[model samples]
Target: MTMQNPVRPLLTPLLAALVLAGCATAPPSLDKALPQTPAAFSEGGVPWTTAAPAEAQARGEWWKAFGDAQLDALVERAERGSTSIQVAAARLAQARAVLGATDANRALQVGLGAGASREAQRGLGVAPNTVLSAGAQLSYELDLFGRLAKASDAAALDVRSREALLRSTRLLVQAQIAQSYFALRALDAEQTLVHGTVEAYRDTLRLTERRYAAGDVAELDLVRVRSEVAATESEALALERQRAQLEHAIALLAGEPASGFRIAADDWRATPPQVPAGVPSTVLARRPDVSAAQSALLAAQARVGVAQAAWFPNLALTASGGFASSELSELFRSSARAWGIGALLSLPLLDGGRREAGVANARAELDAALAGYREQVLVAFKDVEDELAALRLLARQGDAQGQAVDAAARATTLSETRYRNGLVSQLELLDARRSELRNRREALQVRSAQYQSTVRLIRALGGGWGEAA
Candidate 1:
């Protein structure tokens, strides 16, 4: 009578188990783990039409909007050379490699092995026998509980997070370069104004000295005029020092040595561009930080699924085919060949709560990731509001400052005429000149602030500005 194979009886039951496990659903996505987005920003005025997701869009040369060729060049150089960007890119590559490794777990693994051995029974005084073996072994773990799939998903999300971080780093470097360049230019303008004032003061001091020598003015008046010239000259020197410091900062941002880099003195002429703050929801898409945080949260969620899957049984299939012979010449002969195949299903009965602790840890990580994502979203909103308010208030301040500068200039001109005609004291003329200088410097400061705010806003909005198509 023919006997049935013993392992064949278990195949039907194992196949049924596999089918049941196949119906198991994957972990739910955490995409909605956020508060409701406001329709309009508190400081951004009314919301305009919502734009398509800007994260997927290329952030074309937003610096070009300022119409400054120098700024464009500096930002481009910084993007290419910034070390922060390089670090983030390296992290992205690592995450991608991890993903490739995680995916490899789902594919069959094959390995070739060879061995030789000699055996002897010492106590029996038997002769030694030589053995030689060569084989290829294969193994594949069936994803019966979705553990491998969830791990792969987590790895992929990690790659996405790293990619977003790289983009964020690039945007930050670009913005820093632009802001520093503009600040250096503003200082140049201020230094020029101070130097011109110093020259004017020097001329006045010469006139005062001549008048004192002719006995037409007191020695006290001449002494005061000389002191004013010295003070104004000192102020010009201080401004020069500040401009040098700013130039050094710009060089560092551009990835160049401060000792060798130089920016020639130029007029502050780059106009701050008007960046439109579209509907508040668009910030979620545009901001790379926000995107990175969201990806982290999803990855953490997938890890939780992976941890939970640990409670289920693991299934693996292994196979090996080989040639073995005592003599090397007969190793590959048909009679020396061997082959084996196996399927293993294992479930741990006890592990001192290790699996439970793993689940707990993964869940806690998920909670932390969720909290981080929410905080990032809130901070992004706050950043947009802060820059919008700064731009608005600075514009008004600039207008008022312009009027003050105009009035101060008129006062200085009148004071000069009165002093020359001996109708006003030398002290009054000096006060008017100081006021004019202060107003001009303040105006330049307001302009600088506007430019810096524009760059910051672009960064907050993920480094670009344009109407949505």
Candidate 2:
């Protein structure tokens, strides 16, 4: 036992080094923190058998599917100049810089310094002399406890999260622009409908006044006709105001001032693109926001590992070599060389619970990140389901609206024919015309809705399975 004591002392340090190095354990996998995803969406009218293929991905330029060259140009312009996208890009750059800094922490730190100082002796009765020195130093943290590596991994994940967020920002902006553009066109169609009615009312008003002056129709009939014309004009005026506001909004989204931007009265011809209904499981992998949330969770877990490492002892190897002398001429001479090679080991014997607080804080962050990630998943599924329901319901509603438009048109034609022959009262003719106008406007509105819902569904699918993001 006496002979064994000496060898045991030598082996103790080696074993401790191995243990400390082993403390650099990897963070847990994301599956443990993620909530379970549904096998399929609850929304009706989708192809359940179409499991999203592994090769399917989002096309970044989803707006191009609308077949509108103007919209495509606007989206491209916004991609380059939008302030919101610029802000996201700037944040991504910042995250990249932080990652670079963290990675640099793993390398040796070196500095070269030179200084001269004059010293004076008062009571010792000694001569004063200037001290001159020049040297180089280097320090490297050996990552014995894995703190540096953990921190670096966390920073790298942060960069990934920021990058994903950038993509999310672009997707959102493109969707908004499409919705706004379609709405503007719908308004134009409504304006044309209203304007045509105004002209028809003007003709009817002239005929009623002629009848009133000749005593063939009552004065009350003339007043009623005039009132109807005024009300129709008022409706047209309101629609014009709405169109102006919508136009301004589109201009802003296109990254241009309202005063400088204009979209002429082009016919609303953009049709909704047919997007493939992929599997719900594939959607989780496709959404940029969901990816960002997952990355954030990973980064938090890495930070937690770093905090836990604080409890273990730290070890670092250091080496410094330089030449120094009291006289300037001899400062760099070989005879004046000074050198040191050593190792430092630090253990937190007592820290008033500061280290404990750090560990607890890191754990709390991990919990928050986990919750956020699961929430993102839930929201993503909800968005897809909501869009599916809209598309299904809107398709049926548009069909019924088309039938209503046809019926109203027939009624208006028959009523006009009877009024010219004096077979029906003026009020009956007016009622038929009003019904036609309202139904025609409603049909236009439904068409606009179909286009809007289609765009919304595409966005909810995390940019769809066809396009390259």
Candidate 3:
């Protein structure tokens, strides 16, 4: 009694080490884990304007920038009906439920029970006795090593990742709706142009037939004009087929039956809006996919901490209050009352390397998450750059195509006049008309590309430019 026990000295240091380990269980800082970001984007030439921080803001009706009411309605319909968005929302709900379950482990557990048991006596002449018991029990585990906290943190991060995925899904649906609508409108414009060309060709064919009947033109001229008329009509039919397909696509995107849906041909005047590319870091912060990957990485890191905690001893305190009696009717008597209190500390002395394997697996998962996050960031940067390059090149192409169309139209007019005066062959007039049709169709295609690219840029930037709007 006079001398202190030698085990007491060791216990103090052991407890100190355990406390230090618990304190170190927090996940690493995100700044150190994340890859370095560039200060500015590489592509230049278009005016780069600074936009307000959108990381915490909602994307807000970005499709409205196109100034099409029908488009806005379609996007709203898609948002409400898209199966992809519904799936993502369901996943988010599941993650939240898991977080709640993980948190429940930290709260005191309570239970009630009643039982009756009969046991035979070992001695001779002894009869079986029945004992009745009823009780309430409560238990709670002490978070001595931060295991529960780490697990909760991981679950919370999982919820965050699912939330980001839902946002990403919604954005994708909206962008698809915009692109399909713009494409349908482009086809409408092309179809109108082609139908008008067919009418002009028919008129030319009629004039040629009259000339041949009066012997003013050769039979070869009449045949050539007829062929042109047929070819122009065929082109118009092709455009009609294309527009029908586009309408069907838009209907599918809007979650409607293709057979019953239609977009009437109207004037195409929706101009692509100018989108500003903010700083590279800001873009990364705004992208929901990138945010999801980052959250996954953090969750993996927290799981590592949880796995390491398995090596520590677990402590639990339990209490029970109950009634016990040899006679069921007397179970509630004061003399038959029973109560218990317990404190248990358990540590696995030998596990055949199971804990080590778990730690290794957790670390491997953490590495995978880190790599995935890095890949997501790289892809985000690439998307923005690709769309920016496309918009720049498409704008220049549109300008050159416009000039070509003007020149082709003037040539067609002159060729028509010359052929009427018998100064040019019908073949020259046909060539001029073909060139004009080709240039006009190409110009419309370029405009359609501009519209699609603009929508993609908005998606790439994670939304519209909040302040630049």
Candidate 1 per-residue lDDT, tens place, 1-469, comes to 9999998866655565556456545455555767666777778564634455566567788889999988888888788777788888999999999999999999999999999999998899889999999999999999977899999999999998998898898888888888888888888898899999989898899889889999999989999988988998898888789888988887877778889988888777777777644534466677889889989998998998898777777889999999999999999999999999999888765799998899899989989999999999889888888988998999999999999999999999999999999999999999999999999999999999999998888887787756332
**Whose TM-score is greatest here?**
1
Candidate 2 has its poorest 10 consecutive residues by lDDT at 47-56
As for lDDT, the candidate ahead, 1 or 2, is 1
Give the worst 10-residue stretch by lDDT in candidate 1: 44-53
lDDT of each: 0.85, 0.81, 0.85
Candidate 3: list runs displaced more than 4 Å.
1-35, 45-54, 276-281, 467-469
| Residue 423 lDDT (model 3) | 99
Instruction: Choose 1 or 3, whichever is better by TM-score.
Output: 1
Report lDDT (Cα) of residue 396, candidate 1.
98
After superposing candidate 2 on the true structure, give the runs of residues whose Cα lies further than 4 Å from its correct spot.
1-33, 44-58, 277-281, 467-469
